[model samples]
Target: MSRLFGAEPAEEAPSFFLEAPRTEKALERGAAGDLRYGLASMQGWRAHMEDAHTACPQLPDRLARWAFFAVFDGHAGGTVARFCAAHLLEHVLAAEALPGADEEDAAPGAVAAALREAFLALDRRMQALSRAEGWEPAGSTAVAVLVSPRRLYFANLGDSRALLCRAAAAAFCTEEHKPGRPRERERIENAGGTVSQQRVNGSLAVSRALGDFDYKAVAWRGPTEQPVSPEPEVSELPRRPDEDEFLLLACDGVWDAFDAAGLCAFARSRLLLSGDPQEVCERVLDAGLYKGSRDNMTCILVCFPAAPGVSQEALQTECELDAYLERRVAGSYLRTGASRGAAGHPCRLKGSAWAGGREGRPGRIWPSRQASGQVAWSSLQGPFGFSRAIADSCQPAEELSPHTDYRPPRVPLGSIFLRSRRGGGQAPANNPPPRFLRPLSCQSCTRTCCRRKRVPAWWACSKAWPQSQIPASPRAEAWPASKSRAPLPPSPPREHPAVRQPPLILWEWPGLLLREA
Candidate 1:
């Protein structure tokens, strides 16, 4: 019964990698829900023979509400690339307990520590993989994103880039971690690996990787030299409620073909048209290969739709949206702002509320409605909530205590109807409690936090929004105010239900590597 609304902690890992067409370790995803990959160990070219791609199916906002992804570039060999594909995200998300992981990992510093451990853990994991394979040839370069409705974390190792095209025009992205950076080069050298003119070992191009056991030591560490830490070049970029755009993760192959402007331009030109990530990847690759990339070329494009509520409604229920919300059918108040209060409907928000779910505060009485319909969704704090940590000492008793936690957040700003789009929605039916409430049955809706912390209570705190302060205006607002005065964008074509959005699940990876000179 307890398992339904609970989610297992997310063990994130590295992601997809594609190499030269020769060894072609290609992984591509299409309309199919499965991620198709083929690796040919064809002697000399086999390692570079394939590509890596995956098509993720979209889930109901109740499940996946965030956009999460990564890209790995295999150097020296495909080991790191393959390893990353197999396990990077898992390691990153799992290292939350390693040294320096804060009790309340809520700040940028704590996040950085987590990233550091994640990178070190990646090195450790790859070293183990190398030991298991009883050889080297299992390394990779990685770049990943941990995205949530409120924040974003972008981490990386090596020259692979993670570019964020702001929702607005004329905005560039975060700095690239390339050999061109002095500190990056110093880090490579300080690790005992020579940064020959900014490049690791003065031979390979990237400064960081997972499994380049061969180029790892300064000089094979003679029989007595200690091995160096092939830790990653990890960084953090916090995502705010405002200013979000598409992301680009790709091997140098793709970048070599397109400059920052070029890549953004190309992706932006076609993004809204396809709305499918893997297809965007394929087109990018096709563009790169055509541009004559001699190296292994791989790329991943993650597009965050600009539309609100249903984000163009991929799955239009025959039932009125109201019926589905269990509304259109009696006694309801604060429907939209209901879940935003200090405490909310345990079961409902456990279904969709910032992806924290019951993990937020078990035993805490959720906010609710007495009668009549009204808006409910608001920042966990307040209406003008700048929305970061505010040390909730003022919280009511039975509040979910502060603790280090992780929840694979659903998409950013997931579309939830605070009130009927129709406006001044109908009263909701006071339906009897469900005959069966199996917590384990609805794993997607279950909050993942309950697993680590031992909670002994479940309470509901249905407070109301203050509309009394509204001055005499032309029209009273719907509350929360969509954050924007304008309406959401046009609906995307539902021509291919199979091409639905991909689940924002955490992934796993192997180690790092160096595939080129």
Candidate 2:
């Protein structure tokens, strides 16, 4: 009867649960300058270890002043993750945007650009290799940190993350890119794709990744425009020698069990107890396993110069701070419906509110202003009862007030045209319009009004505008006008002999000039 019905005889069912073999625990240690680092990986309940990591005490010859570390969490197979562990740093070293070994003072923006390009290039190479070798579909999430003498740069793709523990609190962490996130979902849909059940197309779990060629088949889309792009989000921050304690880089296997604040506090406690970074890492892996993580676990712990000497008192203070921040963030999220912003800001804590008065004695805790002008909590106390500001010293100056207007002095028109020629000649076909000229609204009337007005299309599109217009190294101007005012009609397009066609303008406001790309 079973054979006639097409049913096979039942055999003993194979158990879905499996335990990790004890032999897979891997560990390594190294040092670079005052930084001591440790790395560890363990195959927890997973059938096989698909996680890979790298820790370099010193980068290749000319780049010896820097160090590199990363964690790659692979799914489906381990090939892509292992490949990244071996070749990712080499690609970064060869990136065109990276400064030469002797370039000690390279611009932060340039360094970040180099890292971004390298990540994309690595993904492209991985795709080409898979196609050539006829490899199966596989991909990995990567989180990397490059430590230079003066700065620390981070790049992340997928859910793997990097975190900085500063002054006994969770300071900085990479944002996870998941299909369910609003921005990630929008990008996927824009590329003619769909997200279901927090996964891309109900199969892949990550929105962005290093190798997964199946999703990269859109012929018209650039690398970044693909639904599962490998392009990483890169950022740089100055090295904070005074307050920076350590850095933690881990794959999702570990992150699934502990949040940024919880992990930092736990690591701090373990570090204080052992003073050995390797031991701290081992303990973290054990903690994750105890928490029932089913994936392969990997983590790297990097102790800064200040870490070894952190007194018992400081450790206690940091734990207190971590607890306090967790409570504050939870309360704020409930009251204001605003989630924690990047770098541990609880509902957008203003810098001025925490800067505190100089007259306040050190080590004294005092109430500071909240977003609503009500006092929220006491300021963090530094070592020996001195008052320490909560703001990170490594924060870029521009971030202090990201919306500050740039004001350039009025300049004559001839120089504006001349400067455009010198600053890179004609703009490229796809060059985006200046921030001031971009459309302000999607309304049809607004678009029509913007098209009717005439401003110097070249002036708005010029790569070097106010600078070229000024005599002798002029500064860029900041247009401070309101962005929502009624559109103003300027001189009609084609008023200049150099411009033949009436340039199309999309939107315009009273104080700002705008043009269509």
Candidate 3:
């Protein structure tokens, strides 16, 4: 058993994988009644494509109003998964006590019982075939959902998962069946099999699967009581068409990449971007691939009538946010020493290190440090041109920390602007100076020392500006550089010149203030 399936630390088992991953994906889509489904499968980093899925929006026979979806994650080989995908539904429909013509007559428990019976029956058939043909040892997870007008039925035999999203939240999710689970471990031990490193007999990872015939060889144990049971755990939930948005049935590969909450959020955001279910499914597969899932991946998304639709407003907002981040990243990269122009600057911040503002605010900034690591302060009228209004906004050096550990407060995005410096200090004829919506308060700044260091009548903290050169405003006195930490002399309140001018916004860039010259 160990030789066929390999031992724990599965990554070391080179026999199960190829030299390189295959990223090709196969996608499918279909719709019936109020349910629309999209399916995507990828070989990923696996040696062969082993995952399979089934999506039936409306089942045939007497249960026309029902929808069925399932995902099978095959291990050792693809035979079991493929067989279940093609024949499981037929077996389910053929169950003697299956839900029939009268919606009211067939109880939910009866429907669940029939589904359980179908799983066991299918396993028996597989065992018979394995005995006759002498097939190689393999097993596959089974996670399926049946959607009727009033209820949803879920069944599971292995670790693949099913999730239902309602009112834009995760309403239901299935638990995985692994040998590590207490009940499953107890059952395995009772059937004379040991679980080591969370694997059955230190080999197969799943506790229950359809075709692991070797584990089902215990003569005294019944089919469901075997170390690796063929019987499935069945469950039912009341269906609410109005509140329910979508249902997700996915192989472990997809689950490994995202939790139920994260998956729901990503799907919702994708739906807002594009309403085509197939495109969304493709994107999900691509994401799972990029997120470093080395297994074959498969997923089915069944969108109910209440599923989210594309929003023009949301799309535009996302585009704008992307553009803003791109510009910031480019600016950060250019300022770093990796650029030819920035080679001389060793204190520059890397492009990837520029984090967005905390608490959902916009813009990125790192506060000034002491004299050794302090930002190279450019003159207001020097090569990096700064307007008089901006220079006037400079806060006293005593107001901020002089240590290298000073961290800056987050600034709102789109609040800061690069003013084009004119030769005669005149505003551009075509473009007026940008007005800041409000002055950023230092009271709530994250840097406690910077906030409590000093309080001035004016409302600006230009940590990058030179204290000796700060232009004195009518409301305050110019702070001398020599006595940077000294207390300021008391002065009477006066009308500020900035009141007549457009409010200027200041942002802390790394060792440099970017401007349009």
Candidate 4:
């Protein structure tokens, strides 16, 4: 089932499960900075949404965030692969954050330990269930990665593999851990298993993994008698600051279609036309299907390029302050009866706002007084001054423990537009507050109302006239009265002399002024 509101129907492909005695699955989050993943199932070689992901927008820096993908190839059934999908990374991260774990340190044995524990835990639970359900232990091949800013921990069990493509470099390029490796062969032998022609017990193809409990049994009868060691060959590579390129983790299904180098070359070529990882992923799927993969095919592509930095921290601060003003403009804290006119002190401003000051929440946010970094009577009284004054630093309202204090970074008021006085000019220190800010209706707003811009229109029927307040008459250009940032509107429109529209005067005035004045 698709999670999206109107998702496209999932496509069905022939199973490569038995095609080359391998399977594959692919997942791509793309360069758009999204989080998505998928798993291929044994039946029909169909893809399953085993686990999906959502990107954390709070941390926009790609380098600061972590991303990884995996592919689990199951031969007998998908029980083991499905189990690993849900729990492998779970155990690794738990191990990464282990007590006294140094972020920089590879935490060498932690991954292996986590792998052993995770697999043992799963095996125990699976055995109990398999006994209850009367089903034999199902096995799977696992290949996965856990990536961070400084390094990646790639681990594999069984035949599924993980490959890396160095930036602009050519090669299948990744360490392969298979049953043939001396250490792997030894591990199996030491556990009382035989390896011939790189196959465990001369039958199973992988040396390490979870759920093959029956094979590990010294006595082929029960859990205590036989158990899968599930010790993954884990490698921690301390990456150069910018050495990251792209990574691929695929089940044998994809390899059956494209050799190790062929898969890497295919991924490299697609990235040229479009950097869409999803498209490249589909291309891998197409390749596998084209090659007649009979088992489930799953491939997961993880690319760490960069993230979009459209709005800077400066812009976010600006927008945050802008949104703050919206609360003031809404008169959030003032009641209807608080208006100066309603209080019968209209013309002469009064300061009755302080009457209800201590009634509600003591630190209640108000549109007429100061509270924390909120707008204040002082700011409204000056039209262009900040509540706490520009020189003041952030301070907590009360002393918590002597060791703990709540304070924000010293925000530099810098060049925030205060308020406007005469039409478009700055409000002077001595000018009386606007009628809106009188005692009964003291309006305390952070952003100046004059920051709005009004661009000029070319054609003018009444419909053509600009909607916002114009800087020049109703017939002219408009701009943020308080901001000098924008250039003045283009010299009044150059209109033909025969144009008789008043609203079009600005458009026609330029030529008329040039010709006559």
C-alpha TM-score for every candidate: 0.45, 0.58, 0.64, 0.45
lDDT of 2 by residue, 364-418 (tens): 1112223443322221121112111121111111111111122122222111111
Error of 3 at 202 (Å): 1.4
User: Which of 2 and 3 is the better model by TM-score?
Assistant: 3
Which residue runs of candidate 1 sit more than 4 Å off their true CA positions? 1-47, 50-67, 97-108, 168-180, 188-193, 218-229, 238-243, 307-517
In order, what is each prediction's RMSD in angstroms?
24.8, 23.6, 17.7, 24.9
Highest TM-score: which candidate? 3
**How would you encode candidate 4's per-residue C-alpha lDDT over 1-517 as one tens digit per residue?**
5766678887887532221221233333543343333223222233332222222211223223555566666655666667667765555444433323234453556545654555456566666667787654567777767665556667676656777766544323344445577877766666677777656776666656667766766653333223235656677676644544567777665555455555666665555534656655665654454233434556666665531112355345534554554344324323222433323211122222211111111111123222223323433434433211111111111221111111111111111112211111234434333222321111121222212211111112221112111111101112222332322212222223231211111111100011100
Model 1 Cα RMSD, 1 decimal: 24.8
For every model in order, what is the number of clashing pairs? 99, 10, 1, 19
- What is the per-residue lDDT of model 3 for residues 286-382, given as tens digits with 9 covering 90 to 100? 5554333557888889999999999998788656644553354335434442422111111122321222222222223322222222222233334
Local accuracy of candidate 1 as per-residue lDDT tens digits, 321-407: 324333311122233322333333222332122111122121222233322243232321133211111011111111110110111
Candidate 3, residue 203: lDDT:
86
How high is the CA lDDT of each candidate model? 0.39, 0.60, 0.62, 0.42
> Cα RMSD for candidate 2?
23.6
